[model samples]
Target: MGMEHSILVRVITTIMPALVRKEIQDETDRITGKSKQISPIPIHLSIFSTNDIAQTPYYDFLILPVVNLTLIDLPGLTNVAVEGQPESVVKDIEKMVRTYIDKPNSIILAISPANQDIATSDAMKLSREVDPSGERTFGVLTKLDLMDKGTNALDVLEGRAYRLQHPWVGIVNRSQADINKNTGLSFARRREREYFATSPDYGHLASKMGSEYLAKLLSQHLESVIKAKIPGIILLINKGIDEMESELDHLGRPVAVDAGAQLYTILELCRAFDRIYKEHLDGGRPGGDRIYGVFDNQLPAALRKLPFDMHLSLQNVKKIVSEADGYQPHLIAPEQGYRRLIDGSLKYFRGPAEASVDEVNRVLKALVMESIRETEAMVSG
Candidate 1:
């Protein structure tokens, strides 16, 4: 059994992992015809010991109902080595959790028992290490009914305690007895709803409580994340198509073409490069404004920070004037000495100037790459 099955039983037991897209018109497409279907589904378990956390298995399941969410079912955090487990199991699990959470693109679902102290929660502790603002973390408090008779998790659910930018949800999960008797999730969910809807402590906010609400909340969150990334994905796809078309067109063209054709081809390539360059500088594209920022903000800022006073101090200026006027010093205006002093001081400006040029070059390269990925640069077809 996977690690998720344990906690998921108390939380999202009935809600199995789902497919991103589904088409069920043909039943034969889903089921195998025994001998004819030699290839099994892509789900596989590694041929390694279960105790080895590093040998984690992965699967690509063809599921229905189209939820489009994936969860990495990692092992629970441990305080010490159990009898059969490795001595470094606790550290190993913590390292594994951090590995997944450290990714900027991942969303963390931090679940903890409501009866325990939230301040000492291992899940939230690890989550905060990676996501200090709690932006990508969703806090789930399970076993709400397990708390003492006089105490409740009202402060946690309402955000008065251990406040987070993202909201927390409380769940009164089914007990061991309910699971042993094989009670349906619907009945457990009904009981959960009744507990919250009628409780003097939770009734005021019953609408936002229970497992059903949690499902809807997670669904909406996943949908919003997917929607946010769709535009960028489309841009990449279109850019790839444009690149392929251009490459094919170039390869198919004659190497021994007429002079007029060669000139036209050269003009076309130049025009394409020119248009892209202008659009970038004019802020007509997404990353276009960076070029202006490099010139206006960064270059000026770098120039201002140069040590002008140190470079042009009176003692240093005098030394340079003496070096310039060594043998044939200008008799009257001393133009050579003055020019030498000015040129020596100007040397300090070279460092910032070169640095600005390098920064601008890098920014232009990134801007040109992004412009090709923009809708305007992509092939229309």
Candidate 2:
């Protein structure tokens, strides 16, 4: 069976693997246990043998019925290659496990078989690296019945070595004989309780052994973690609410409180526009003088400063006539000719007038936008 089956079997009821229809079995056995009817045959099994991460959720009805918990059983960290896996596979799995354990919110559950050396286990070593102070890491010692005769993990369980904030918990997994006989998990749990209760070497530590006790301990630990983070969570929520309120204020509507107030604001804007228009037309200092004064006075002054002979030349008259009439000839009566010549004389000045009006209009638009911005700023403030 795969890790998914192992996990579900540990925490939930037994799920029988289908003997027929591999595809249907794979689809049906999701969450409970992945069907092994379609087992893959590879020349070599790497840490990424399946080339997928199994995200299994575990729920305990017997122990922490009211609380739900999720536990991840990562690939076993080992340099040994019983299945022809390369040595690099061990390192790759170590890196993957370290990435998850190093996260701030993670709680490390370092599971080491009691039959093995606790200090030498790769799982325990990795846990130490993530939790240097041993504050959040807990140990679960499995296969209590498999340990050699006259040997026990009492020292590790009692925290004499590999000390963690939460002491080690011991559990007994189902033996091969139990599995062959179709013995359920309840029997396995009862067997564990009995072994720890009667055995001279483990009876005193009965409170710390068995799956039920471990589940209850984990539930309590999670509750404490939630309680500890409540204040910080609340603080963040309040900060987000305040930020949203300020943003809403910043984008508030431009409408005034009442009709009279809105009318007054419109009138004030109209007056401002009128004042600016008059100022621009009159060559006031507020409007740059270049638009009106340069064409009106400077060109004439420069022309008058020229020598009298040069000023009276036909070329000069022709140039003025050409510039005024835009170089296009048109027949007219004497009276109309006088009016057309005057219009031509003022043709060069039309540019400045148009430019001045455009500038004033641009300034008025900017003032309106600024007033809106100021109103919004006041509301936000």
What do the candidate models score in CA lDDT, each in turn? Answer: 0.70, 0.65
With a 3 Å backbone cut-off (N, CA, C), the pairs that clash in candidate 1 are none
Q: What would the per-residue lDDT of candidate 2 be over residues 1-381, giving only the tens digit for each residue?
A: 122232222223323332222333443355325422211211111111222234446632222222244455455676654444455665666776776789878888888999988768988888887888877888999987889999988998888977888978988888878777767677778888898999898888898788999989988998999999999999999999999888777666456779899998678656665555555546452444544454466555554544545544667655655555554564553444445455655655555556556755665566556555544454445
lDDT of 1 by residue, 1-381 (tens): 121111211111233212101121122234533212211122222222223233224633322232334556556777887655567767877877787789988988898899999998999999998999888998989988878999999889889888877788888887888866666778889999999999988898788888899889978887898899999999999999999989876555445379987898677656766676677778565555766677789878988887778767889777877778788776787677788767866787788778878987888788777655452333322
RMSD (CA, angstroms), candidate 1: 21.4
Candidate 1 lDDT for residue 307: 79
Every model's Cα RMSD, please? Answer: 21.4, 10.3
Q: What TM value does model 2 have?
A: 0.64
Q: Model 1, which residues run further than 4 Å from truth?
A: 1-67, 253-381
